[model samples]
Target: MVGYARGVSRVLVSAVLVAAALLLAGCGSDAPPVSRPSSLPIPDGFTRVGGLSNGLVMAIPSSWRSVDLSKTDFEKELEASGLTGATLEQAKTSLRSLQKSKALYAMDPASQQESPDGFVTNLNGFCQPSVGASADALIEIAKQQLTSVNAKVSEAASVPLGQGTAVRIRYTLPLGKALINGTQYYVPSDKGRTCVVTLSTDLTGKNALFDQIGGTIRPV
Candidate 1:
């Protein structure tokens, strides 16, 4: 299970969002009326996005332009992560396997002004070592890699996502004079896999797309 966490470790990328607050700010476009179940109402301008190779799909604000990370250092980072052919292929497979309402957007370390909230949020999937693993273990894995000062964890419990349940991880960090909060709702996926949806924002709590976004995850 720990090994899985290591591979799914980009959860740490979120730390970049919270940690930066020690320095300074708080943190999209258009598209279709992607029909959803009555229970899951997608807000206006929330466009469907996903990886072409991976079946991963999800709805993001249509106002937020599609960020193509493939051309960015993202690929280099993945390569440098020490993932070999088989492991890399498996990782790709797990993500592409997602059917609907799963998305990953590009996070630009350099440009923060382009995004509405001065933050980048994303959705993704990973192959896990154990499908039945506990939420605490996964959270701990991310926490160990995070260098947060006076971090406090809350709402660490199972919550419904789409047709399945996810471990909702909410935590706060004090960076410089700023208060940063991050949330990750993790779901175990098919054939020992995990899916993660993350939100990173300042104490202002300005983003409102997540609640509508959460409902689009189709039950596996």
Candidate 2:
């Protein structure tokens, strides 16, 4: 999954969020909540966000702001994160590349404001044709790609996500003096596509929180 590698690279570099493409148009506005089984463990106070057309949905912290990647004006948010000049421009470029692929991105405002070097803690998701590859193989590919970038693969296993289980890979990448901790979930979906959900953060020991949020992914 070259797309998965590219997605991971973008997150490591630009600090963007992830999920399936065609997420609801209005970034911060509440979309109609998808009906979910009560047994599913969604975090308290989290908000349900998804795209109506694609029927893919995930829950994010209510405090996190969803960014409409297709929209141009996130300059205020970037500026608020203390980004300026080339770094800011590179980030915008990375985001726009995701936008071109119709991906969904979001970020935690507090993390963004507190980061030492403007690497915003974030999540992003997008769907790509699986072409008959098994979920395990896809995740292994991601693991390899991450390892190539000097990211330490801490864990790799199957976990409940969406309609079935997903292969979850947790890793930490050291960039300069900062450690970026993240998890990527690979869920095989209907119609021969795989849905990828990723979460990256500057804080450490967030596996529980990350899994809790990733577990909420579902295709409507």
Top candidate, metric lDDT:
2
Over 89-146, each residue of candidate 1 has an lDDT whose tens digit, in order, gives 4433333323232345422232234344443333343222333545566666666544
- Worst 10 contiguous positions by lDDT, candidate 1: 25-34
Task: Give lDDT: candidate 1, residue 2.
Answer: 14
Off by over 4 Å in 2: 1-42, 53-55, 70-88
TM-score of model number 1? 0.55
TM-score, candidate 2, is 0.72
* Model 2 agreement with the true structure over 37-138: per-residue lDDT tens digits: 343455788987656333356888898776555345645554554445665565565666566545566667666556665566777776655455444555
TM-score of each: 0.55, 0.72
Give every collision pair in model 2: 17-123, 17-124, 18-123, 18-124, 18-125, 19-124, 19-125, 19-126, 20-125
Q: For all the candidates, what are their Cα RMSDs to the real structure?
A: 11.0, 8.2
Total backbone clashes of candidate 2, pairs 3 or more residues apart or in separate chains:
9
Cα lDDT listed for each candidate? 0.44, 0.58
